[model samples]
Target: MSQAVTLWIPGLLDALRVKEAQASLKDLKLPALQTLLAKADKFAVKPQSFYEQASFLFHQPGCLPIAVTKASAELDEFNPNHFWLSVDPVQMIPDRDTLVLVPGKALQITEQESKALLQKFNAHFAEDKVELIWASSQHWYLSIVQPVDIQTTDIEKLAYQSVNAFYPKGNAAQYWRQLLNETQMLFYTHPVNEARREQGWPEINSVWVWGEGKIEADKLLIRTDASIHSNHAYLQGMANLTQSHYCAEPESYQAWLNQIAGFSDPGNGEIDKHFICLDSVADKLDNLQLDEWLTLLQQLEENWFAPLLQALKRDEIDSLLLDLGQEYRAHLKPSHLNRFWRFKKPLNSL
Candidate 1:
């Protein structure tokens, strides 16, 4: 019989124990909560391999962090609801010992990677057990309990018949990738990394789950791969991008787009369509910050961007626009052609 032996080192165990899983952690508030699950781990296979070597989690109005939860929490003004904060029954982090989390994306890894993944994960994850109930690419939940003593084939059969199966196509896939990358970095250098590695544990290269509060071993729980701990360029960029945003004037652009055709919540089946429409048409206009672009709209009224601005203004969606205009006025300079961008381009290009 192949016996599964897990590594139990001091640094690793202590580090995992010192997590925000306890109820007392809620007192840390939003800023502190943001500090957990960093972007780079020193013990990673590669020195500076913080996963999200790309992208950012900007703090713009629409691009705020979206934390997942079962129900909405009337969080403090500062914390509020963030993109990283998901509030759905599908997402739940258990306060109890054992927990299960269905990732929102597909993660590919090998058997060896699986063991390393568990050790690396167990190191910083202050949990007793994780019955990582996973759904195969075919959308069938495989009842395989990780780090547990139970082996139930019947449960696996039942899961195959009933397990939330929804593919994370576009936006979700991107978010999941970012999350895993950041978590990998955090776990890499986490005190647990060296201890676990010494025990011959591999690394968690990739993985995915259906969603939050996934059932494992007849228990309900939630899990998220938000751990990140790194000072590398990519990690820094992820942090910055998650915090910064290009605020532009002329908010009516959004209202104007809404007033016209092609705007909707599109539901789950057509989420890709929703993002494409919003990103291509509406968000594109809202994200523009060039002073000349706004000027062109205000002056010519016949310029390419003029009609859109006029529509937004006519629809009375001027909150962000007004704010943008006010901020730009506070620090206007002839040299600054665009309030959002500083590129030296042709005036017509504006």
Candidate 2:
């Protein structure tokens, strides 16, 4: 048994951030939530950075920490088998519940057997935490049991502890292999729309529970190009956090830009935009000499991002410009960057 393992636990309630459009949540208390996020900065996203209720997860006695997330949220009507998998120890695992961690399980175990198995484990060691881990159920028989290494970091090494009855193996390896091949093929220049991609029954992507020992997803491959521009608050926050937390000797925000700017989309891409909360980088913005921000944006458009994308990616990080309104644009030069919109709120003295 391993002694120490680093399980990714969603932070406590005070750490997460939750955000919504002001009008969408008029009845809700936002200041208190923002205060909570201000302290933790717990969870983040690509388009925005905010916390989620999942941050306060506390697993029950026997439940496993696993979740089924849809491959794409836009898809209508979720079929159990169409989704991706993520491990969230605090939320996924409930006490007395067993978590089966597999990529795409196709088989569903019988209810009676599943219940019996649950009773069996809970009868003696109900207080202990365990997992039924596997890659794919190709060559194995039905059902499995084993002691788990809670301290294991590498998921592959922490295989199942006990083995149950074996069954006739299927062409699962071939199936998974084909799935991976198809996924890559679908994303090329001539992308296939989801409606036309199905060959079988559901005609949709779905997640499933196999009878133990099944691989869930194919390898994930998304490349961040060498040169690009624009702002994605989530990515920005992640990059900032990475620099602050991982890099021993700290570097400037500009340096982060210079380095990440080297990567851009290989395909022709459009300019992306994002915003950073003023408070997060307040100190850094105080010192400005000779329009340094504009200088960086222009450089990125010409030599850095444009060439890489075979098009261009423009970024607008002018938080100052955001508040200045149209008055600044009137006297400014033609190239003063007029891409902005402002909305003023009325007094809240109701």
Candidate 3:
């Protein structure tokens, strides 16, 4: 099987805009990228949200990353049949028109704080068979005994946006709404919030439920001899369920490239597909840190883009696939390098 590598870069388009505005990349010679673009076999140029794109890669049909019932079970050897939902602790700020939920990472919740909150939630909802699990400060899970045919929004979609716009929508919407209301009340005076407030930290005033689903293995698309690596909790959980080797994302592609002296196969020799998710750019862009975003782009060009191009020229890898989580993707083959006459559009323009 020919080897393929996928890099999911969020906010890549916006960064391209920055490059264009400043003509910062005017002199940037990314021969591999230019050749890849010129030789792209399939390219989708429309705009799409990162969540939608990444979800397609890791999630099964109707399954979301936040719903870790199966993945958690796969990794922990627990039961997979259950309703799993991502119930993130967030701080809601009331805007003139609506309340906006702060991003979970920005909330800076601690493991101790999340555990405390989970304890309270489990006890409060014990009779309802709703249990909360703490994965980390920013990643939390909720397991329910029965399934709710509810369509919930991904918190990523709600971050900095009006909560009402993406509120629960389904037959069980009211049930979820009531649960959310009760959850807010349960957390309002909790000591955890009190302490965080005292420390000038954002209080965990509310819990947003999204990525709700029952684990369904049939939804995941998997390839034989392919290993998926990512830091995303949901992706990790899904990888567990899919029996894919899951590892932390390397600091940069170069760090990983340096370790692979000769790419015979990824460790096991059975794996040919290496998927690395670099999300720092997406995070910086989401937080509106333009300076940080630009810096990361430069770092990637040097460490990732440049080296990968050289490797491709040497036939170290057969193909490179970039799933930008936007509507567009770049699928490049080594032969695409010969199309020197193709108009070279700025990376962002594509």
Kindly provide the TM-score of model 2 when superposed on the true structure, using C-alpha atoms: 0.20
Off by over 4 Å in 1: 1-127, 133-304, 312-315, 320-350
Provide TM-scores for the models: 0.21, 0.20, 0.83
* lDDT on C-alpha atoms for all candidate structures: 0.25, 0.23, 0.69
Task: Please tell me which predicted candidate would have the highest lDDT against the true structure.
Answer: 3
What tens-digit string does per-residue lDDT give for candidate 1 at 167-219? 23343455544543445565466544455468765332223332222112222
Best by TM-score: 3
* Worst 10 contiguous positions by lDDT, candidate 1: 1-10
Per-residue lDDT tens digits for candidate 3, residues 198-263, read 888888988898877776667665544555556665556656666666666667776766433344
After the best TM-score superposition of candidate 3, give how far the Cα of residue 234 lies from its true spot, in angstroms: 2.6
* Candidate 1 vs candidate 3, lDDT winner: 3
lDDT of 2: 0.23
lDDT score of residue 112 within candidate 2: 40
RMSD of each: 23.0, 22.3, 3.5
